[model samples]
Target chain A: MMTSPDSTGTVPVTALTGLSAFPLTPLKDGQLDQTAFIGLVQRLVAAGVDSITVLGSTGSYMYLDRAERERVIRLAVQHAAGIPVLAGVGAMRTEHVLAHIDDARAAGAAGVLLAPVGYQRLDDDEVFELFRAATGRSELPVVVYDNPSTTHFTFSNQLYGRIAQLPGIISIKIPGVPADPEKARAHVAAIRAVLPEHVGIGVSGDAFGAAGLIAGCDTWFTAVGGTIPVPMLGITRAVQAGEPAKAQALSEDLQPLWELIGQCGSLRVSAAIAERQGLAAPDCLPLPVQGLKPDQRAQLALMLDRLGLASL
Target chain B: MMTSPDSTGTVPVTALTGLSAFPLTPLKDGQLDQTAFIGLVQRLVAAGVDSITVLGSTGSYMYLDRAERERVIRLAVQHAAGIPVLAGVGAMRTEHVLAHIDDARAAGAAGVLLAPVGYQRLDDDEVFELFRAATGRSELPVVVYDNPSTTHFTFSNQLYGRIAQLPGIISIKIPGVPADPEKARAHVAAIRAVLPEHVGIGVSGDAFGAAGLIAGCDTWFTAVGGTIPVPMLGITRAVQAGEPAKAQALSEDLQPLWELIGQCGSLRVSAAIAERQGLAAPDCLPLPVQGLKPDQRAQLALMLDRLGLASL
Candidate 1:
């Protein structure tokens, strides 16, 4: 499945399962803090995350230019040591996305994640062709991102099936729907039935990762896990060991962070929490994107202490 | 006004006030066709376009990586042969954009054009900060882009006044609303009143460029004009020479190409038209975007013939 274009890097295409960290791409003085980034990736690998997804939602791939994105990917792959690295490759233009795929392969990533990000309203055919063309050219395996809120395009069951059949596509990241559990279950079940046996279903949304994991998703695509990885991994382990009650408790432990994330979105809340914990550098998102209001940070501090995550 | 970072490359920012070509960014097998791009830029300069926008919307600025965008800007500036070259300095991130400004300045560009291109809805404060940050860092003049259809954010009257006052911001690109004639006139007039006298208002929309010129707007931002520069220049010359009817007729000549662009978008239509005109190499916008179907190509050929623009 994940046939690395280079023979030197051989890892299973489905290696990115269980708990994966979409780490915060902390920047210092308007430039990437390479040491901080290397520390974050190495932390995830040491903590035993299934994969390190560099330039994920938490990593702010949209904010980075081509050179910065390539540098981030290379840093993640190099410091990951033996751990698998999945790079994010999303852009408004198809050729730009194709170029990112080529960059990911050249950087020796385990796989590249893609989203059909464009300003224009892309029809089903356009979105499908986007994936078809990207996967057609890429040597690295791809994880299709179905982020309707951001990309404004959902990978429908038919589209998912079509993408699943595309060569080098190994996974689909199904974003969480906290408001409708039944719909989420049905959606995942329908898509799972259509997807090939080898292809995996990853669950995004720190708020709904436990529910998704319980609903038979293969990976917990957590934003909080990227900073405070222990709780996320604890939930993953509980679920893997068939202890739903323990997983439920661990999932409950993340409710405070998830609630804050739900308030202002992960981009701000996660960075604020990381800054408070002293795990990440200041200003993850660009300026004018307020990290967290003073009151919100206070609540987050109290919650972190209560959950024994203040020292993480 | 366009103080190139390198002192050797001095050009007035207002020099880009006439017919300016936003050229097709030709790619051969997914790589930038340097020869074709250089030839296209050289052609525009030779034909006497007031400016050559290296990474305009037609050039697919959103699609190119930092290295490619840099290469394009550098190549255009070098081959511009002392003509002013306005470089597109837009990116989803602030630092990436700031980096692009440095790149454009280092590449010896006359000035840089910017747009609010973020993944999420950037608030008024954020947009202001984005410009303030960019202008504060660069020696080059700035052209604020207000393509709401593409950027999903309109530069309001307040915003126009605010950005117009920022240091190093010499111009603003006001996209013409030809469909709503009354709205277009009032919109431009309102912003013109607020803007500083030093800041020029350039008009985008090839179809409405003549009306914009008549209405006191400065530049004719043309996409089709990049490949067929003569007709666009003829309109500008007519407007400058105080012949409104001639300018109108010259603008009408672009109607057919604009109609095709209205159907499948500029990325498809421009590349197709450019490929047909032999102004660019085949396969400009990656695969599956398609270079005009046979019927569409036939229609385009007829339009080019009817306008007597076949040799342009």
Candidate 2:
């Protein structure tokens, strides 16, 4: 899976390609549910995800404290077996992000994801300087995370070009590609045209994974893959095996679940899925983020049954 | 300014009315410039403001760590010189927010401002529950801060009605009133209709402050007023004396400054103003938030001079 390094001689940028599962940091009794968390991580490892990313939006990284985040990073690295662990180190302040990066490096994380998390609306230059300071602070490979859904900061292609020029930036995790096949290819291609050859462009938003991959996204940073990795891996492997039709059909089969995820955020629905499958405690999500209503849970159960994902 | 008790007997809800200035937390060499911050507090007190609100978005509260926030809270209270100090205790997690409420209470703050600061977009129910937990945690009066520019979580009128039902919510700090006078009055009236009589409606966005005050808003939550309070107090006094024209004229005289604020955001503009006034050291803003470009600073300086605000 190694490729020749283009700029940052140390990091194999191609390692960022393929399925990177972002697992949730489940909690029990107002504390980190280590057993459940490890189980989730082990599932990703067993399903042979290309990389395991902890403390992402799916992981409720913002809700957890420093010590809790450190624990998640350590546990993820410890139980990931041989899978490369990428930890999210985003915080409201750049200094805190640097501290998280240090912790991730100390905990043996293969890379770190940095999002321009905002309270005050951030301008293009501020976001660029944040990445500049972050890349300067650590040697670990960096992924420029642009999730406007959570961070509320959008990245322009020009800004992406500016950031990718910095050393150690191995990937750019875009929010998603366009839904249509041709538009999605054009969108990813436009971004790819700006980025260096060594930096990979990964796609998020679970439902867009197959289209993004078939359109030439280097990786699919899947949220549901953390809890239900089998289907996600099926789509990923199908795309890798040059079976675009199979990948599209597999993705279409999960439309009901994606519809539910669209109704409720992926974070809550993923927690509900894990809980329904007996993979985590009933209330695995952090407080102020109750998973789902009873009716919603019932609907999710029926949807899973219809999708034949009830047993998975 | 004291008034009879409401549901929360201990908090003086009426004290939240009139002009409440939100000051910047200027930093020096990566540490809080306590002397500069105290001077800002003293300015508000000497200007005879109704209350001084510290640790707001203008204060860069989200960018600070717990220890820094504690220091700012303590220093603000210590130097407010008996002026009621309202501290922002908003965090991403309810538990962390509760802990901040504890800190604000311990620091002798007169009230606490809560905003649903979101990384994941919070639903109305979650925001309501957050306030319920916060009010249950402390006896201080609470101001529901609804600044969508920073928090990215908009509070609907329905959500405001729901949160106002909670005890200790003395005021709702709305983003702004409409620009048109008649529309502004109707806007405030609509919100007031949903709120309890005891709960006041405050307005933010410096440009809209005078319009809001003239339209029956109980308080003007101002960013520019924090750095330069004389003109702000003039506007407030004129409105109180039933001279809406004078207040409108005063607000219009500073259109240049408001335009700057609108362009660069209040935080960066306020920092630049503080730095220019020699109240705070150069480069007062924290890392990754460089105050302003040289051209913007030049424009701000000219605006201050044209408005005859440079001497103040």
Clashes of each: 0, 0
TM-score of 1: 0.84
Q: What's the C-alpha lDDT at position B118 in model 2? A: 82
Q: Which ten residues in a row have the lowest lDDT in candidate 1 chain A?
A: A3-12
Q: Model 1, A1-312: lDDT tens per residue?
A: 544344434253554579878988888777788888888887798788888888887888887778889998888878886678888998777877888888888887788889888765576777888888888885678889888767766667888888888887888898884445567678679889999887889889888887788777888888878877888898898889998778877777678778888787877777887787666676657654547768988898898898788877
lDDT of 1 by residue, B51-114 (tens): 8887887787887778999999888888888878888988887767888988887888888889
The docking quality of candidate 2, as DockQ, is 0.71
lDDT of 2 by residue, B1-312 (tens): 334332211223344778999999999988889999999989888888888888998898888888899898888877777777889998988888999998887777788898888887788888899999999897788899999888778888989998999988899999998898999999999999999888899999999999999999989999888999889989988998999999999899888888898899888888898999999999898777788999999999888898899998
Candidate 2 docking classification: medium
- Per-residue lDDT for B214 in model 2? 99
DockQ of each: 0.30, 0.71
Question: How big an interface RMSD has model 1?
Answer: 2.8
